[model samples]
Target: MLTCAFLLIVQQAGNASANTRNGRFIVTITNNDQPAHASLPGPDTLAPPREATFAEGRLAAAQTGAHSYVSPADSAVRQQIEELGSANTRKRVAEQDPPQSIVDTCRNDPRADGGKGHVFHRLWWCQEHGFTARATDTNGNLLGEASVNYVAIAWGSYTSRDILVELQKTTLGKPTGVFSDPDAVRFIIGANCADTGTGNGCAVHYPTVNKTLTEWGNDQEWHNWLITSDESKSTSPDLVLRHRWNLSASVEVPGGTGGPFPSPTPYHLIRCDSATYFAGRPKACINDEVLPYITYEINSAPAISVHDVAVHIREAQDTPDLTFPPSPTPKRIPGKYIYENPKDNGLRRIPEADEGPNRAVVRQACDQLRPIPSDEQCDEYPFASTMEGAASPDWDFSAKAVNGRENTRAGGYLRWYVFWDRMLYRDMDSYYVNIID
Candidate 1:
């Protein structure tokens, strides 16, 4: 349609790839309905208005000869083929290239809707993961609030690793890509960008969303966490490396309740390497072991706050039947046995740091609770649930069935946030445990 630099909206909707739609990609193409230059009026300017008559020829050719079906923009914007006398047209077409949409399709043919008449698609075995993500924007509201619809296909994938890959790729694009702006280096893809294909977060992420951000609502429940990153920013520091959230899609109809969000599910930082695994051991061969923060949420409720506890408080208190002492025991616990490291061995106690923060926290715990089995009530807080390689370490973990959660305002739990990485004593992550009150 010709106009005075007219404005028109073209939405690339539909799946047109011969490749599987779910084949690691949601390819979108702008336009797909166009006739081949060969099918056009041969070298005739005075042919039909446009190639609108391409269907019949397309169908006929598909049934017989080999038809070259380029991109929608490319199909119409190509240099006229060396037909009877279309050299001039071909030159003009070549000089003008194709439309911006055509150019975009060449680079990234956006995935289409469930129909046809769109750009061709392919599975890009990208070394990178996080890219431009999209989502639905229709928050069904009546008169007071207006709504816009953002149609995006939701995809399930990694958050940090993918974003990291994209960052690395972006780095390659820059003069060095190793700029000093840490956030820029990390959240380059930006936040909330992961609306479409999500696992924890979008394009870019930050750990502050977990650490620094003010914990909202009450305690003893899951908390709705939100973080954003722009391709213009970095997500490394702000993002809990490997952490991810399971997302569900919801559409606010023109007349529906919007904010009583369902409970937030548990999300653990996905090992950047966890993507690849051996059947024998689920945990990949991680030399520098670092586990992501697990969502300490009960049910699907949003948690009120996040706390760090000793690794002992992560899961329910289970005993490792390895007979220690005169019976039989190992000095160190295996992380794997503690449900931590597969090669994890035995874990004892920090032996009290004598002073400083370690001693302080212990002392504080002892004072807070009056009775704890005895004086070492908080002392012998079952440093380790000790459930490695045995039917069960005949110990009652009933009272100790503490999942590191504390009943406060919304929901709170004790988790460990190790300063660095440790493969052996996987106890570094969260040392915060909730007392069964």
Candidate 2:
């Protein structure tokens, strides 16, 4: 059961693709309420090598649908939105169906990126979708959040099983050795526009309108153990006490020079914070648009540190049969549905899931049997804290100048996205190592 989770490249578009053992897989989304779908655009639209049937799961998205852009009643944009789903929608004719190698519980099987917990979904989706996405809402208004598959594993496995076996025999088996590889990180990048805010008229389903960024780059929220693993010391039991800011990170603005003033150099998408949404592409931004730029950076450090020290706690409590003993064997068991913490505002959680008022007392969680902590919002383009902090009463993403000036100052902390490659990813590409999430 792969819960729907994601952070996107700067803003939302239709599809985002990521690299994998089999090349790449694309993520398709409909944040605008206008339900949209996609297919590979080569010779014959590549059909999902393995088509897994979705069971009777309740829809987490709103049912509202609309088709317009910038302005709700814009007829021309509305027409363009209408053609999103049905446009170039391709389906393959012939491909052999392969046998699955493993059988995982509903809560775990069919999972391609779950080893990373919830936040990974965001990073994975951002990478996959952004790789080669063409964002155009089915409804121009960008206000139609009907229903959609948050992500689809479109690479080699074809089916979840094919992907899982390789994972089990390799990564899962030797988590210590395999997960350390930097190339292990697999991902892609996409492009599109962003709106202002609620006042700008972005609906609940496709609240994606309003202020938008370019790419949603992320990685596995900081796992204390993963952090220490890279360090020579603290090698026992894979230390799990480190604090990790799930999506907290630094960004590398593609084609960026030194500041955010000149606009993303390439201006991936015209962003205007004045007229509620974008102010609709100003001539200044259009000409100054560069590739990617550091638009937002998480202000928090992604590492967890203990504020106090503790002595031995009665040799720790007895544990369950959590390990596989000393035998070379595989384990299997039944499980339940995974849910989001009632307190979580992310769609990654369910409608009927648990909820509470206080952030601390309200444990954001899922119903899954495994006590997996989900960093659901990490890796969303720009950044979640950045989003929650975007239009705060104190700060404003719309501020033309951080200090009331026209152009941003030099050495300014221009926000940007950090496209993450997971610990298990098989690619060892170079990186800027901007932030430490």
Q: What is the lDDT of candidate 1?
A: 0.22
Candidate 1 C-alpha error for residue 437, in Å:
42
* Lowest summed lDDT window (length 10), candidate 1: 1-10
- In model 1, which regions exceed 4 Å deviation? 1-323, 326-334, 337-417, 421-437
lDDT for 43 (candidate 1)? 18
Q: Write the per-residue lDDT of candidate 1 for residues 1-437, one digit (tens) a residue.
A: 11001001111133323222221112211111212121211212112222112222223223322212111122232232112012122232234332234334323433222111121211011111111111111231111111111111111122212312111111111111111222222111112221224333333333212110011111122112232323222243222233222221111211122211211111112222232212222122111112222223332323432222222233323343321211344233233221222232223223123224433434444455554443122322333222321212432221121223322221212111111111112222222222221
Clashes of 2: 78
Please give the CA lDDT of all the candidate structures: 0.22, 0.17
Point out where model 2 deviates above 4 Å.
1-241, 245-437
Q: What local lDDT score does residue 422 receive in model 1, on the 0 to 100 scale?
A: 14
Best by TM-score: 1
